[model samples]
Target chain A: MTYTFHWEVPLQNLPLFLWGALATLEISGIAVLLGLLIATCGALARLSKHRLLRGAATVYVEVIRNTPFLVQLFYVYFGLVVVGINLEAFSVAILTLTINCGAYCTEIIRAGIQSIHRGQTEAGLSLGMTQWQVFRYVILMPTLRVVWPPLASQFIATMLGSSVVSQISAEELTYAGMFLESRTFRTFEIFFAIAILYFVMARLFSFLFSLTGQKVFREAWGQL
Target chain B: MRRHGRSWGWIAVLGIVLALAWTASASAAESTLDQVLKRGKLLVGIGLGAPPFGMYDADKKPTGYDVDLAKLIAEELKVEIEWVDTTSVNRIPYLLTNKVDLVIATFGNTPERAKQVAFTKPYSSWNLVLLGWKKDRNIKSYKDLKGKTVAVTRGTTQDIAITKLAPEAKIVRYEDDPVAMLAFEQKKADVMPTAEVLALKKVKENKDMEIKGLVSRSWAAIGVRRGDPDWLQWLNTFMDWHGGQGKFAELFEKWNGVQMPVALPRW
Candidate 1:
């Protein structure tokens, strides 16, 4: 069997792929930021004294964490359309990724918060710090330092999972690759290029997180 | 942490094992037509999101020529129609694996494909035409498409035809007709390979586009399992009876807004 490798098909669409990569980054980046915000609120709610607040947070985390991301994406995109709530594919993708990532990040951040010694809270309170002030000035920064690596890893996972958005025909990296592959019938070449691109993107996310961690957590880590 | 990772590893292994077992069980079923008849439903596979052939109308109901034809066949068989939405690529797999009794998708009949599945007589045919901006005088012939980018739906006859006709041209495949049309309209592609009817619709809808060149005429037929001679004969007979009553032409005009050919070719 003779095999001819045509790398030209995918390469010709490099501009389109790059645009798709940019979109992937934009979605994941926005989702990560939004997830972080939602996670903080969720973690806080889970720690609340009100039973209803804690229960609601627990349900959100458990439901999202247990269900597949693909299912969640379909429900948001297709199910919403059924109810006359039509959302653009890109918006739906960002919304779903943010919600899904928020659940995982909530648990991770909550764990970090719980890991801190009780004396730290006492230390801040005795210094005339309000509850919110203690969280912002003392507890929050340290908790982030403890959870940054795992949270960053989850962000990377979210970046990779963004590929699932193509199911709803979102113009992301995988969608671009699929479009090229279908036209050229060069499935291997297209997929190989996509695989390498995804790998580089994942590594890029990791590298950025590492640099941020060093800058933000240098004191909290306490040493080299 | 080590134990958690190890447990995940075990779960992955178990998942793969279960998936293989499930696939094996899924494929080794009995005769598809028998299954369909026994179930009292003609499990017909139809393509979704392909306009003028199979697509959802404004009412959000599946409508088009392929769907109408499938409904007729199911009515003749004295069974309820269960429309299983399929893609251009998965139609054959859906039939061979007993997922559907008949694939009435826009399935082009080709010799390479004949090895895998049985096809009935042609229900419809359309020329694969190149479409480009009307003002683009540079793209009048096949030679002009040497290095141009062309948009086509993935795994469709137009995609295959374009690949063979212009190996040098960059072809971008979309998931469906509407997406490919969007790519064309967005000027992401220099041209698009689509059915003649679809190309004409594009020209009528957008004053900028017109047919550039003809690739090849492709005939679409109902696909069935390879070993089912009885099923194939029944489908052919159904097509002939339906065609004689002029229902095919009625559907042709209803969807295409033009008269079909005097007779669709018989093989």
Candidate 2:
């Protein structure tokens, strides 16, 4: 069987696609950052002095982690308007991904937090460090070193997961591919290009994350 | 005294048992009749968000024309109907991976698609309609869309037709029709090419958009994995029976005002 094939950049679509890929990167990046903040808070809550805070964080983690991301995305995009709270699809994409990634980030970070020896914390206390100082320079900083690799991996997963936002028509990489394939009727070719783009984006993210890790943890990189 | 040989004998027996089980499972998978009977439910993969086809009603019940057709198929097989909602991208995967027993989604049969799957006889027709601003007479047809941006959902007949007709018209593809609708509402695109029913429905809701012309004829059929002649014959008989009994006309009147065109062969 002969296949009528025309595979090219479809010049007119390039700028829009470039703009879309940048937006995807922005959404995923901001989400991972905000998600880190949420994870820190959530992980702290899991270790909080207050029972209610711990319960609340546990429930939030369980619910967000268990449900389908697509369902959560729709709930976020449509549920807002249903409650007289409206935001554009881009904002919803960021917000939904932050919540989605934060749940797992909380668990990963919690493990790091728990791994900090009672002896190191005691040493900080003996050195006349304030509770907040001990939590920061001693506990949090060291936990970060322990958790940074897994965190970078989650950030990668978040980038891939953000592709779900295209369902609400949030014009990311996958969304752009959908548009392109539909136009060209080159589903195989267009989707093939998109798969490569995703693979490249994933690799690029890992490379950058490694560079950032080197900058953030110079001593750790030296040991490596 | 012979412990090593005894262990080896047991391992050889385990291997033979596993091989027999694997063959049994392979043969069992193809007996779809037994599957349907055993399950007592026919699981169909469909997109429940699309209107006039597979869609959810206000009550959250799956109740579009395709939903009814899926129900009919289940009833014919003497099984209860279970609907699984999937997106356009996941539909083919759902069928190929055996996630669902069948699919009644509004699958547009294309030469490429025919390679991966078999299609039952066409049960419904879905043609493309050009929707423009209600008052725009200047952009009536493909000839007029030159240098204009037209928005359409990805993986649809409208997308193919627009590109085929007006290569000069810059096509902006959206993942869903609603996004294209928003683009049309915002005047980002000169027109939105979509299935006729959707165009008419969107035009009605907006009351400010108008459908210009029917662009191309298409047959939307229930899709199954390729090399299923047994399944295909069964589905064809079912479709032909229902199509002749005027179920489609009833479905059309039921699903708003998109009538089944008389020119299209029903059975």
Candidate 3:
């Protein structure tokens, strides 16, 4: 069928969409950072000698990784609201995103920690380092460097998944496109624009993560 | 394996030819109305998430004004109804594709949509409003909506209205009415543009929100496939009878808990 295509609608709403893109970045950035913190604890727990600690951490990771992220988000946003714990949409988005990302991040970082040789721990202990110091300086830091690339990609996936939160009406980039499409009936133009914007944002985030990685772990990058 | 594959391919070809012949004969045998009558069922599409108009009850059965209306139509036609739960976005598509003989969704009649499907006479009218928390006295009108966050269902009548009224407002659109309501309830949005009836129900339950003001009014009508003059006339006649007998108003009040409109605009 023949039809006219208009790019003007999305063009005029460019500023609004850019603002939403920034929100998406902010949500993903904060969620990833917070997720890494949770993952560190989870990874350490799974490695702990105590059976309770390891079992609890393993259960947390398995349950989250097994279920769909959308269901988890809905449970957190809708299920909790029923009990009178009403969290704002943005906070709910970030909170669920972090917990969902944490499960996978735990697996990645735990693998990195397990891959470490026993000799490194022995050398640190021989040098009179305390257990906490050995883990913080010798094990955790190096394991993070080893898992950095995969973890960064995981964070990127989390950012893409953030689009699903628009179901809850969080004012993210995808929400902007849907809002514009509803107003103008220019579905093709708006979706095309949003697809391009998301592609650019994903690349931009990947580049930023690489730059930050280089700055934080110069020696690690050299060895890689 | 090769001999088995050859035999299976021939069977597939024969199956396709038989299916084509069956459809060709079926189309040649009767018109759409006659087909529906002969089949002893009318396929109707009804909106699922729009409460008071079309929504599922706690028992998981569809119960709403539209559902009741469709039931009446089916009774008059002396046929059973097979309902296809539809969304605002897909209701028209469902009718156009012949997936449903009629759409009793809260579908608005507009010239833009008329080109795609035929609209029977309007059965109901609902006014849209910008509603917010009762304590938020600052937002009295559309002017106060500037730079505020408003939630609306995507591609709905209210969504388009708010864009025209307050272009500067940050409009957050959801997939359906329920999600939009959830967003407003969670205080994620400063205001919401929704139907007056829907907003009133929420206000009465929450005791914290009020209808700020009117936004726009839309007439809801039944939709049918294009080029079906006979079927269209029958549906229009059914609505005329129902409306004339006051059954429409009775159903309206039964679902909305308010009096029906005195007059629905003739399309």
- Give the number of the best model, judged by DockQ: 3
Pairs of residues clashing in candidate 3: none
Residue-level lDDT tens digits of model 2 in A69-156:
9999978876666567766567888999999999989999999999988898899899999999888877887798889889889989
Q: Show model 1 residue runs off by greater than 4 Å.
A: A1-143, A165-220, B1-16, B56-60, B89-93, B112-116, B240-254, B259-263
For candidate 1, lDDT tens digit of each residue in B101-154?
888888898876775577888888777888898888989955688878887777
Q: What TM-score fits each model?
A: 0.63, 0.62, 0.74
Candidate whose lDDT is highest: 3
DockQ of 3: 0.19
**Residue A171 shift from truth in candidate 1, angstroms:** 9.1
Q: Comparing 1 and 2 by TM-score, which wins?
A: 1
Q: On residues B131-212, what C-alpha lDDT tens digit does candidate 3 reach at each position?
A: 8988889999777898898988877778778878999998877778787787788776899988888888778888888888
Looking at model 1, give its docking quality level.
Answer: incorrect
Native-contact recovery for every candidate?
Answer: 0.11, 0.22, 0.31
Question: Cα deviation in Å at residue B196, candidate 1?
Answer: 0.9
TM-score for chain A as predicted in candidate 3: 0.94
Ranking by lDDT: 3, 1, 2
